[model samples]
Target chain A: AQSVSQHNHHVILSEAASLELGCNYSYGGTVNLFWYVQYPGQHLQLLLKYFSGDPLVKGIKGFEAEFIKSKFSFNLRKPSVQWSDTAEYFCAVIPLSGNTGKLIFGQGTTLQVKP
Target chain B: SQTIHQWPATLVQPVGSPLSLECTVEGTSNPNLYWYRQAAGRGLQLLFYSVGIGQISSEVPQNLSASRPQDRQFILSSKKLLLSDSGFYLCAWRSGTTGNTIYFGEGSWLTVV
Candidate 1:
């Protein structure tokens, strides 16, 4: 079974602070990784995705994630975060070998950016 | 541009009541659709998915069921709702011909009392 793990449960940061959320997946084959964010009273939106090629992928809202195959990790990072960045972040993975296109998501990490 | 919509934004249903949640996708054809449930303060759990009309897949054994009556429409239902069924229900879709970047709908909040 494929599963995702996020190390952080909650993180508090002041505005303009650098941010990094750890994500790891358990899969042995080719995998697709993604980071999704759900703001308060908003739907889940795709932050970024890693399908092939570039391991470092940049997404909307100045967010980026790097896929490290060796460690099976795809950690999201932002050089500077604003108060609007507060939301629940989820890490997801889909193993190509399964061919089911089903996504396995992590428990999620809540980020609170204070102004 | 593709978009997915799931409705009744919020619902308060009594236990043992019937449920029918509808989801539809626009601007895409033959897309893969999925139904997921997010319990309070928890991760998204895959409930059902469909590859095409009349095709459905269940990921977890529960009192809920799903159906795909049209190529772009997916429905989740239950004959009798349980208190545990109260949660946030989300509908998502992914391109069948391109990358596997799944997009989620606004989500529906179900509160079973």
Candidate 2:
């Protein structure tokens, strides 16, 4: 079955710490990838998306992700993380071979940034 | 800007009770609507999707059904709720002409006791 995987389940970091979250998918052909974040008591929001341009995509709040097609991986990264950055992150993708707008999302990664 | 509204924000239902979660989208037309469930360890499951009015596709077989009565209104219903049905249900939409980036609504928390 098609799936998206996020290896990190829960992560803890102190303020100003660098962060990296790994995401991988088992899909072939062209695909659209996305990163979404959900703060406490808030709805999910789009952080970034990769269609067909550069391998590295920049998003709001200084977060970025690099898509490696050979490995089927799209890893999210941040140079520094603040306590406010504590949230749940999800990786999602939609294969474009016979695409409809359906997205397959990972189990999600919970980040806890301490002050 | 496009916006999606899903409600009621939270609900508690007993087993065997009926369930109905409604969603509507504004600022866009003829969009693709979807229903997804977020469980603790199951990640996000695509329950259903619709491309047009009265056109619904079931992605998973469960105790749930969906309907798109109008162009921008999608509804998820279950005749009898089960304990396993308790989870976060999110309503999402994607532009038919714009891109594949799907936007989500404030999810509804369902707790079936």
Candidate 3:
């Protein structure tokens, strides 16, 4: 079974602060990783995804994630975050071998940016 | 551009009453559709998915069920609602056959009172 884990439940940061959210997954075989963001009152939007080639994947809104195969981690990072960047971020995993076509998500991290 | 829409932005239903939620996708064909439930402070829990019309897959065994009547339309229903069903329901779609990005709808808030 593929599962995702996010250690940080709530993150508080000031404007222009660097941000990094930890995400880890448990899958023995090939896997696909993704990060999704949800603003208050908005739907979950795809921030980025990693399938095959690049270990470091860049996403929308100046966010990027690196897939560390050995550590089984794909952490979301941003150089500087704005107040508007406050939202809930989720880490998801899809096992390549699973035929279910379903994604397993982490508990999620709530990012609160204070200006 | 592909867009997914879910109806009834918010709903308040009495316990044991019937429930129905609809989701439709536009600008895409034969999309892989999914139904998910989000409880407060919890991750999105996949409930059902469909590869095509009349095809459905259940992920979590619950009081909810899903159906794909059309290529772009997916419906979630429950014969009798339970208090545990109260949460945010989301519909998502993927463009292609395998290994695609999943996009979500605005989501529907259901409160089983």
Candidate 4:
């Protein structure tokens, strides 16, 4: 079975700190990558997505993710994170081979940005 | 623009009681609907997905079941709820044309005591 892995379970950072959340997948075939954020008591929102082309993709709220096929990783990064950026982050993947629209999500990382 | 809505934002039920969570999508047709369970440290578990009306695919076999009676509506239900059924439920949909991204709803919180 295919799986998505987010190594970080919990992280704490002060405001304006650099942020990087690691994400990795099991499959090597063609895949779509996504980063989603869930604020406190809120639904999940798309942060960034990497389908094809340029390894690096930019998303809302000054967040980006780099899709490294060789490493089988699509890591989320932000130069400076704010308290508002504190949220649980989740990574998702959808395999395109004989696709049936089944999406797999990671365990999720809880980021606490201290003010 | 498209949006998904889930009902019973928060509910508390006793074990052995029936469960029904409804979801509806607006501004899209022939969309693929899905039901997910959000559990601690487990990420988003894909419970059921539908490509068309009355066509449902279940990922995990559990006490829960799903039904898609309409093209843009999906429902998750259980004949008898269990204590383990207490968790957050999310409804999502993706366009058959774009089919690449899935959007989630506000989610329903169910607590079985």
TM-score of 3: 0.93
Candidate 1 docking category? Answer: medium
Compose the digit string of candidate 4's lDDT tens values, residues B1-113: 88899998999999999999999999999988889899876778889988889999889889999999888999999999999999999999887754368899899999999
Per-model TM-score versus the true fold:
0.95, 0.94, 0.93, 0.95
Better of 2 and 3 by DockQ: 2
**Model 3 DockQ, alpha carbons vs. true complex:** 0.64
On lDDT, the stronger of 2 and 3 is 2
Superposed by TM-score, candidate 3 places the C-alpha of residue B91 at a distance from the truth, in angstroms, of: 0.3
Clashing pairs in 4: none
Give fnat (model 4): 0.65
Backbone clashes under 3 angstroms, per model:
0, 0, 0, 0
For candidate 1, lDDT tens digit of each residue in B1-113?
88898998899999999999999999999988999999978889989988788988898999999999999999999999999999999999988744668989889999999
Q: For residues A46-107, what per-residue lDDT tens digits would candidate 3 score against the true structure? A: 99999989899999999999999999999999999999999999999877774556677899
Q: Answer with 2 or 3, whichever has the higher TM-score.
A: 2
Ten-residue segment with the worst summed lDDT in candidate 4 chain A? A95-104
TM-score of chain B of 4: 0.96
